[model samples]
Target: MLILGAHYRLAFTHSILAFSQVINAATHYQLDYPDLALILALVRGGSLARASQLLKVDVSTVFRAVRRLEAALGQQLFEKSRAGYLPTTLAQSLAEQAERAEQALEAARIGVEQGGEVISGIVRLTCTDSVLQGLLLPALAQFMPNYPALTLELSTSNDFANLSRRDADIALRLTRTPPEHLVGRRLADISYRVCASERYLQSVNTTDLASLTWIAPDDFLPDHPTVSWRRQTLPGVTPGYRCNSMLSVTELVRAGLGVAALPDFLIGDGLRPLGEPLHGYDTVLWLLTRPDCRALRSVVTLFDELGRALKLP
Candidate 1:
């Protein structure tokens, strides 16, 4: 009986010591929220320069913050190599926890911001430049005046904004598949058509499409549907002009510079459709927001308004 009782005491003592060590470690590492944010961004970005861009700080600032974090923790969080900074196992675990904390903090902030009865706050919207000019801005011009207290900020980028990180409150994107985490619906089916100015069509032989001067998306957009379509359908034909911007290609088509494939919605005023909508190149336009932000009055109002205005018949 004495031996069994002694064994139990030994186990209890070890448990207490282990608990104490955890407490001591926790007390030793006094990590700030901003530090945690930096860690998360670094893990996501995989480079100091990219992290700095995400955090809106200088590269030196990001580097110093990382060094400070390592000093506090007494361990390296990342493996630096020529390729990029790779997160250690410990860093990945910490970043996961930090992400959860970030989401909670963002939820709380949204709750407080929406607590007031007035639907007034900034809603940051992000989308590609073509979508901004061809679709959203026109609808927003009509929608914004209705909400006098609200402010709408726009960000144009080809890459989808990271909605999980609250990079933007709302996003309008053209994709076959929208991120599952975002709350939204497909607004419209985007179809492409061969388009040119009426004068260009009259000037060129309509019977031989391969012989006409073609305007194409530049090598920068090699993966663009029109680029692939032109390459596959027309084979040996070469374009007369190439542009990096889809909007610019549309403008060139309207100016009679050359014929180009354009989304049906962009075939406005001076442009005329030369052929039917292309097959297997249809994409859907989506209006999306973080699930947490969907409940915000301002976001909800703008989301609904944009949905209604942008939905194609």
Candidate 2:
């Protein structure tokens, strides 16, 4: 009976050892959070292009991530086809787990953001150059000094930053319809006016609208309101100058180069509006932030400050 008990104890010890080895081997390779995020995106989107779009990365980036994950796991996660990448069963399963982890991480982030009275950390904001120079910079100059610990970084872009991907913590944009996913309210109506310098107005026959030299946005800005407005307002008349930047157009008008439609916010000194705000080029200035970040103290504070400072009287 003593010998039988000794044999049973040896077998139990071996079983425990084997289980420990299995766990060690399983945990040897640490899965990257970025790779897991890519996997979840691919599983949800079902294609490399779709995943890239959702992740705000290049298609090659997603492809390389898949290869890296497969190599680390020593298993194939996806099968390539003409239709796109089809996730294997393991990929789907892992994605499900990763989604849960992602949710937990997001909740954790929100909790940390709302945890304290401290309004610190960097807040990234994206907007057009004109808005930065004319509207936001001044307001920020006054507001930022109050919060010494908080840092505000600005990125100027012609296109809207992808808030879902966290390209910027906040965005100030001029649009007729703001994106549904973002949280914000319109600050004020953005009105456009036909403006020119005193010198240009004096040189041209103001009475003869067709004969005056005109400044307009170049073909690169095909979707710009000025482009469409010019096409509709002056069918055959060619512009004297063309520029891709609205700020540059404003400068040209200020230099007495020609007349152009400019946003009301950009009508600084040295430029005068030739007429009342144009009829069809109505837009609004929207102050937007990610829904997840709405509760963040820094974001909330800046958002409220900008809303108050920028609201038109």
Best by TM-score: 2
The alpha-carbon lDDT assigned to residue 207 of candidate 1 equals 74
Residue 260, model 2: Cα distance from true site in angstroms = 0.5
Q: Write the per-residue lDDT of candidate 1 for residues 1-313, one digit (tens) a residue.
A: 1122343344334433432343226447655568778989999999999999999999999999899878877778899999899998778876876665554344334334555233455688998778999899899888777665566888886555567678898899888888888889789999899988988888788778899899988987787888888888999889999998788899888888889899887888988887789898878899999989967887898899999989977
lDDT of 1 at 239: 93
* Residue lDDT tens for model 2, 211-298: 7888888976787877787788888889999987888888988999889899998998888888888888778889989889977877
In terms of lDDT, the poorest run of 10 residues in model 2 is 1-10
TM-score of 1: 0.60
Clashing pairs in 1: none
Q: What is the C-alpha RMSD, rounded to one decimal, of candidate 1? A: 13.1
Mark the regions of model 1 whose C-alpha exceeds 4 Å error after superposition: 1-116, 162-165
> What are the models' TM-scores?
0.60, 0.62
